[model samples]
Target: MSNQTFKFKQFEVNQDQCAMKIGTDGVLLGAWASIEKQPFAILDIGSGTGVLSLMLAQRSSAEVLDALEIDAMAYEQCVDNFEGSPWGDRLFCYHADLAEFTEEIDDQYDLIVCNPPFYSEDYKTENTQRDLARFQEAMPFEHLIESVSKLLMKDGVFCTIIPFKEEDQFIALASALNLKVDKRTRVRGTINSEIKRSLLEMSFCEPARSDDKNVINTTELIIETTRHNYTEDYINLTKDFYVKM
Candidate 1:
């Protein structure tokens, strides 16, 4: 296991030497994933170092939680993290792609979460391993929709985060797969910056109230402000995991 610990409000994630390390995107998705009323079972696609899975385990009362990772190294790391966590018995990691796992797996989950690779055409690094983890060619938007459509239970919900620029196209693809946008959050880096990411939760049926936006400025707006200091709202939202706010 990696020696790095991702301290959260109630838990700490030890992620080191994993192909996909813990990042702001995963943290936001983990903290933002809707677990209202609690879910009986949950799934995390592209589980990476299992940060989202760990976060869900800490926040919800789900009895069964599973994570699927296509990368061999990441799958192993996820398994290790799960085994070391308090919810070890209830959490499991599958070393297979989503499409392949869905074909043989029969169980359905109430909630599913994913922080998928969104850089479809972005320039990739020379490292093939890192490219596989960061690039989108491994799992395109279309493929994600199809896989989620097949894996999610009739009453289940699928949640994910993507680049804000892809919002319109993502919604269209989800619609084609029979999934409706249940909730949408447009996130901005700062008050002055343009929207950069969109956190989406989709269901089989349309939500009565769905669209919402949140402006999260993680860093200090003024030069006198110290780094790592967060706003009140940001602190409140992620206080559970970050050791220092």
Candidate 2:
């Protein structure tokens, strides 16, 4: 769990240079994000160590797997990791602010994935880079959704992971931009633990909702039945990426 290199099934991520090291949230989002559309281009916003982009590259035939990392150290490391990955030819990293990148990039993506900064609290840590990576002020949900709404293709899917408490608010914001929820999974560490995170899949195009039944497919995911004893669903969802799943 130290800020060091993390080895996966098909690839290894060097995280020594990144303030925000690899975590379960990013891995879960990468593995759970649907790629059924067979996207040709993919974008990973706030890519951190570029692990999400790497995972998608390994799972799909995306010719263009681009990652955006604003932090200088993380961005440089992301580029290096992308170059070292097996999908080096397909993976590319952009070291620019998301707001600017969204404005400058004219091409739309078939799939857009993000493990965005979630915290919106007023606090500061001794380590500024970590704070920037973890806090919402660095890239608020508003800006993230606005950019995704603009950059996503007509049929493209946008997937992300956020706090369970923020699910309602986030979905409401997305709805305002005409992004409808396709699927949602509430995540918990253990069966007894309160819901911790939410995995969301949204798109610009969605069929009309039926009054008789729910339109957005929703489910619950328990990561572990007990400490280090992963649940069957959790293993199945992340086995492709985790080294010892």
The candidate that achieves the highest lDDT relative to the unseen native structure: 2
Residues 1-245 of candidate 1 have per-residue lDDT tens digits of 24577666565666674666788778788888889848899999999889899988988889989999988877888888888888898899999987889889988889989999877776878877678888888889899888889888898888899998998999899888778787777776665677788888888753435563332223221111235555565666666877775
Clashes of each: 6, 0
lDDT of each: 0.79, 0.93
What are the clashing pairs of model 2?
none
TM-score of each: 0.87, 0.96
Candidate 1: which stretches are off by over 4 Å? 1-3, 206-227
Tens-digit lDDT track of model 2 for 1-245? 68868999999999998988999999999999999999999999998899999999999999999999999999999999999989999999999999999999999999999999888888788999999999998988889999999999999999999999999999999988989788999999999999999999999755656653437899999999888999999999999988898
Query: What are the runs in model 2 whose C-alpha is more than 4 Å off?
Result: 205-214
Worst 10 residues of 1 by lDDT: 216-225
